[model samples]
Target: MTELNFPALGRQPTGCPPARGVLVCWLAADGSQVHVGDRLAEVRVADDRFGRRIGWVSALATGTLWHQVRAGEVLTAGAVVGLID
Candidate 1:
């Protein structure tokens, strides 16, 4: 099985802190088949200057999706969001 992790969004401009975000929603359903680059979920990131911004999380492999995180959950860089098997 392959893990689907929340991707790092780089550093903040002011203090160079890592970006933190929340899981907005899942675009792909659990147990659904997905391919590489498929949109898996939506995330809302807290930006210092830009406020909150929405982002899409994509699948890294082709397999059945199993969610490890739920909507509205807090997220950090490299957090395990799901699994593909």
Candidate 2:
């Protein structure tokens, strides 16, 4: 398993949830082959009263996209939401 992990959300100067967000959408389809630097999915984090924070998870290595996360699913920091190959 490639094991795609969640990336850190914003600077988050304070040591808060490293990657707290909801899996909004998937740019690449499950089981689809992806290249390096390809956008995997979009995550939305309800940071504060200002607005929701958005982040993108990208593929680190060229391989097949095997998503371990689902749309609208809320996840925490450092969570392994997917895998490659």
Q: Clash number for every model?
A: 0, 0
lDDT per residue for candidate 1 within 1-85, as digits (tens), equals: 9998886655656666567899989999999999999999998888777787888889889999999999999988779999999
Q: What are the per-residue Cα lDDT tens digits for candidate 2 across 1-85?
A: 5778776665665755464778899999998999988989998877665468888888988988898879888888678888888
Q: Per-model C-alpha lDDT, please?
A: 0.87, 0.81
Q: Best candidate, lDDT-wise?
A: 1
Instruction: Itemize residue pairs with steric clashes in candidate 2.
Output: none
- Please give me the total number of clashing residue pairs in predicted model 2: 0
Candidate 2 is scored at a TM of: 0.83
The 10-residue segment with the lowest total lDDT in model 1: 8-17
Give the runs in model 1 whose Cα sits over 4 Å from its true position.
13-17
> Which residue ranges in model 2 land beyond 4 Å of their true spot?
11-19
Total backbone collisions, model 1: 0
